[model samples]
Target: MASHVVDDTALAGFRTGLAGDAITPGDAAYDEARTLFNAMIDRRPAVIAQCETARDVAEAIRFGRENGLEIAVRGGGHGVAGTALNDGGLVIDLRRMRAATVDPRARTVRVGGGATMSRLDRATEPYGLATTGGRVSTTGVGGFVLGGGAGWLDRKFGPACDNLLSVELVTADGDTVRASEDENPELFWALHGGGGNFGVATSFTLRLHPLPVVTAALLLWPPDMGLDVVRAYRDFLEAAPDEVGGGVIYMTAPPEEFVPEDMVGKLACGVLVTYAGEMQEMRDVAEPVLGLDPDAEMATECSYADLQCMFDDPPGYRNYWSAEYLGSFPDPAVERFCARAADLIVPSPSQHVLFPQGGAVARGPAEYPIPWRRAPWVVHPFGLWEDPADDDRGRRWAREARADVEPWSMGAVYLNFIGREGEDRLVAGFGPDNHRRLAEVKARYDPENVFHLNHNIAPARGRAG
Candidate 1:
């Protein structure tokens, strides 16, 4: 860890050049600025530079490098690993830079790096245009898109990176640059799934698709019925259209109007089916799962922006999440998946999820570094709880869930879904060949590895620094 005591004179000079405020240890908002989504992460940075523009980002980078301070970038502060903050370093906080510009006629939207999914979705909602966004509305668009975004609409619109038009970035040398197909083409390709290894993205322009409304159905049954329900769901999705998207989740049933009195605060199997079309069409297509006689049901047609916020997980919980992509989901796998649901902590927000992935996601450009996109099924164990004593239990359940389905493992996992597993898993996220190519790009843009907090890719050897 790079540690250098910042003097009062130098600190004052750095703050004067920024368009935003610089928070220190004694500042009133320092504690709130360092807080992240996962309560387990309690890092206190030496300085938090709340940037308001690309110039501010560049200035912060230069200041950190000159002062021998390790730099970390903060977008939505939702990363499970909490790499967005360091113990005694500089944090380039982009939370204040959130701004979105919609060009409906061109079918594109330019969003600031600090912008959340809610800002982007709502900006395009009135125009009846939207792109693939994070499942949670509060998720940061920059991190989500750069980490290969997946959502309910990905089956029809493809991953968020596929819709990327261009990015405005500030490199390690404090030099501003633009990357697209026609400009800095190699850097643009690396941005697809390479994460923040190369530079700090100030803004992104993404292509939008025409989407008027969507129908979402949340059907629930007792925990014992998961095996049969999952089998039926797998069969239904095998023949379903690309417009249909959803997943099977085993979670603690909430006390909603539709939930049965006995099911609340207990383990229950729920199936969500989101249709890109109308309610009547969704009814016709989802007949198989809809006929399963669920004990609780909620189906309605609403705006796409509204559906994004429907299942937003509350923050301030100790979170530990992992994923395993499977090439096939056989009968034995179904049994194992259901058996693990019993181990989940009851009356908590943890979810044992099975998501389908073979639509526009599979057909999208295969050259991107996202190797997990081809897997037909993904087993994600998302653990969220309120008690510190349950940390070991929460982590064990997520790890055991992945161990249960390792037989059908695709060997490639989404980098965003899991924390720092290992170098082998990091290489698996981007294939062996893509990793090599990304290293070369990293050597060109950030040879010193200034942005090493993410699932880092080292600079290629024997390259100019």
Candidate 2:
């Protein structure tokens, strides 16, 4: 069936006064206008309003309501589920609102919702500083923080949401409000890991941290060493200091300058490790795993910003992501992880990843909106395919792999890893109590549930009038 298109003639009177670009379906720039980071998701909204200011967002909300159109708010469009796009809806694009104000002495940064990781990292790196951010430099800070971002320094620091000091958001009713622990405390709590249920966040006042000089690198192990590698990793992480962070992925090794071409496309285990502390302590920490195989190369010191980008696969790749938290990595689960990975590799560049948890993630869980505070690790099946024909194949491999780990799971999923298939995962992301509170906040600020585009949280059904 052909999709509905809201006529440009209908919006003609509305577009002229706004400070941002509004593209309609037939516009020449419409194709690029609707593009996002993930290639697997393809949807075109009826109108794309590339908003440059909070006022533009408010105007977009007003327009969508008056026109009876659904709304999708795009920050960095790095969401695994492509929540940034919509079919037959209106998109409020905040990409142009990229300004950032860093207060280094105060150890804080007030960043626009549209700011990218590269933008944030570059702005703070000069002072040897950083905030919790995604591994990819391209990830939008807004979406990353809102969904409880875990990055290279997450073990040393906490999740991004934990560092957030305040947020400026535009409500579903075209009203702007500032949320923080001391101010709108309820809304602030909900904003921490609440997804986009409450509103379109315009900016964030996030706490920053000092970056320690560190050794970080990808330790590649042959496919035959998967068991030895997973075992060594689990053991090393147990005694590792908070300054150390790592995640292991079963992947097809790349034929890069650092990787031997003879091993190109060879199925192997790649451990992305980052150690932030004194160089001597870093060497001692890595010695055990480096001793496992003489082929395990020693890591080199790199800046925190560079280290974060080291493992993030490039954007525009066709991919599917499914994840669950693990209370512990038992012997059987390790065997299952490696065994199932061998069978689930769909095509080129797919990775079965196991990210270390605990450390700062488990600290002060009572202060954040995230659930699954006790989980010690996260297991994600990242299905990547270069062939469009292999879409279904890639999806099935990810699903079957997830099934393999279901029994070992901690019954919680990361909000960022969720997409359209995760509508129910939203409730699972936050616990029933937090979800209920978020729904109440939704009812108070947006009684009609105007922001329904995200992993939707329907209003508390509202109070009895």
Candidate 3:
């Protein structure tokens, strides 16, 4: 349990063998390297290995284990739990490995562990192809996909993990491995939603779909209309086709050119719909919601890549987020969901969101550890605000949102949508049976739980102890 005091000799040796720089606390860019998307997390690792290749990742893991340093693997550093960092430890920083290679002919993309959604999207845009990705462009592909990614395209293409073809990983023993349906099959199954628990994913090869253009519609109204709007949106999504996606959100309206002046910076209720089709087809599919007479509306066809960046949530804010999956969103659930919106910190960048999940997301491989996929609705309380003074209020609001939906809750949750809740929630992320299977896989790949910083799955006792 003692901490490792990395000596000059060991540090120098690690630096000599790395293809990229090994940054230390004294380094000029150390602060920037340690910075995460959430302003609330602040940890100082003894060494940060900015890996540039799979080999680099392996070497970094070896160095960390040999030096007795607690290892933290960091990609885009967007995880709200701050597991991407560890105090007085070693960090395998993959931010420099941001290459995304697209094979247009094969309809696949090989993205580096550190590559963000922006990199992945832009790489495939020219090919008129895309896969399920995080809603924010800045999210790291490694964390998002491994954690079971959800996005605007999820209803059509399914969760990101469903599209994942393979992963190149570096295990706890500093060995390079490949996981796929055909190779290391059990490990591949675990990687579906087991997250960074097994090892550091050096790169991911994911299946992409042809999506030249996507139609997006944003219809907004005052906060007072939340109840009626939420109910209508729920009813509409119940029968919506797989091609339809998006969510109902309550947030402070931004001062975009399309937003009315009165709505900007005020609490507003809105529905964003994305369709994997032409504008006319989307208009026809969305006619029911369109008839609601929104105070402000913006509907158009845009590049899938461009549309991915439309709702980029700005970082550098204090963040606390939580999610609850629901088997159904009845009228009472809708009322409770809308009522919780009142607790959200208005005039801030927080969002009270309800995402529909019954399309391809629900239809994805049922065998994967992600039990939350079977749910039809997901209530996501994304709390982001500038003032630290509102931290308590933000946390309470997110908790209340989940509590209000407990009556209709499915118990299973999406790990990526939440911060560190506790062991029960972690176990619930994967159902009991899936968790046991994932733990066995963890036993094989990372018995010592070296990659324990994520939504961790402790290895089976016989293997680890």
Candidate 4:
């Protein structure tokens, strides 16, 4: 990890690390091992240290520090801009560290930072328990919580960061500390929405709730109904119950049995709504949304776990994401959003989704330094594709789609949804108080900035930076 020009001997030391496998630039498995979810990011790191335990992470950090090499910590390998895997750096991969332990009675669960949303959901759903998380099943715990996770249950519980009770992290100086409300309270606060600027989180103790059952619908509608659908969505969000969640997605129709054959490749909108509460209440709250469009797939109730995997993206497809906070939906701004969808027309018909953000998410732990504290809704534009050649179009559309809504946005973006745009936006993620606090905590735990590849926030008096 020295100057993007590492030699064989240097990578050899990392290859022999304990409890996991390592991949170098020339190894047969390098291509499969190093790639992340977002194809837009293409950095070639000198070494990939796939770590299985916290000790492995500590060792990699120390090794990189002593050898004067750049370091990157990869958990789920889904970083949009690929911050999880840095070029020419020693990557501390934690994919093998996934382990989840649940205590149903106590309503708490301890999960590895390497775990994905689906992994966590499966482990907890049997006990009828759930946690705040992103809508997509493959989203990683590390990035989502560090940046303030938003999900359907956020209205009832809180952001994924808010549900975080504690974290076990390996600091830059190789110190393993448990951060909670009382134990290293400062570090705990910083980790609330600090991204991975301070350290590599090994495991997290999270709060959970009863997810008794789910009543949901993926209402598909015509392309021209985009404006009407957006207006209807705003009204629903304005007064929707805390138990109700999910977002309205405007995308191009796919050629599938569920979709109308005649509408393939045409722009369309679908409200993928979900609610977990008394069945009657869920139906009452969702009825208005169902009436927005002329035709729908029909509303039905199902198991919570079934709902969790509803929007799964194939493992190998490329994904690009961007999000922004809307101040408010005054006088049918939903219609405006629909108008844009109708105009530019996203690159792929199957890749766009927008959802509201206020609800319980707005009320983060009073002291937490989360961005977008009070936005009514945050719009996320995703570009998904299978054809490798369509990569440029996906990237171009994702950026341009976000840009189209710049006027309505509050200049605030979700950290998890952000790419490798740099640290300025990381600062924007958690305003100055949280950012400054995170920097101080980073100084105390990782003065040299060993964990610098993430949405990094350097220590107050860090290395020459």
Please report the candidate that would top TM-score against the real structure. Answer: 1
Ranking by lDDT: 1, 3, 2, 4
| Clash tally, candidates in order | 0, 0, 0, 2
Candidate 1 ranges beyond 4 A from true positions: none
Arranged by TM-score with the best first, the candidates are 1, 3, 2, 4
Tens digit per residue, CA lDDT, model 1, 123-241: 99999999999888999998999999999999999999999999999999999999999999999999999999999999999999999999999999998899989999999998899
**Once superposed on the true structure, which residue ranges of model 2 sit more than 4 Å away at CA?**
1-10, 294-298, 344-347, 422-424
Kindly give the stretch of ten consecutive residues in candidate 4 with the minimal lDDT sum.
342-351
Sequence-dependent TM-score of model 2:
0.95
Model 3, residue 151: distance off in Å is 1.0
Q: Write the per-residue lDDT of candidate 2 for residues 303-397, one digit (tens) a residue.
A: 77776666667766787888878888988888888887786553376789888877888884675658765688888888866678888978887
Error of 1 at 47 (Å): 0.4
Per-residue lDDT of model 3, residues 1-465, tens digit only: 445789899899999999998999989999999999999998889999999988889999999989899999999999999999989999999998989999999999999999999999999999999999998888999999999898999999999999999999999998899999999999999989889998999999999999999999999999889888888888888889999999999988888888999889898999999999899999998888888989999998998888888888887999999999998889899889888888889788899999999889888899999999999999999999999899899999999999999999989999999998999999999999999999888888888888998898999889652
| Clash count in backbone of candidate 4 | 2
Candidate 1 lDDT at 25 equals: 95
lDDT of 4 by residue, 1-465 (tens): 355565567556765766777777778989877878766567787777878889888888877776777988887777777778777777788877778899999999898978888778888888989988777688787778877787767877888888899999998887799999989898888888888887889999999998877877777888677777777887887888677788878776666666677666777678877887656777677888876654546466766666767776656666767777788765545655666565434445345667776667776666778768678787777766767777776667667766766678776667877676656677777887777877888888777777777777878874332
Alpha-carbon lDDT, every model: 0.94, 0.81, 0.92, 0.76
Model 1 root-mean-square deviation: 0.8
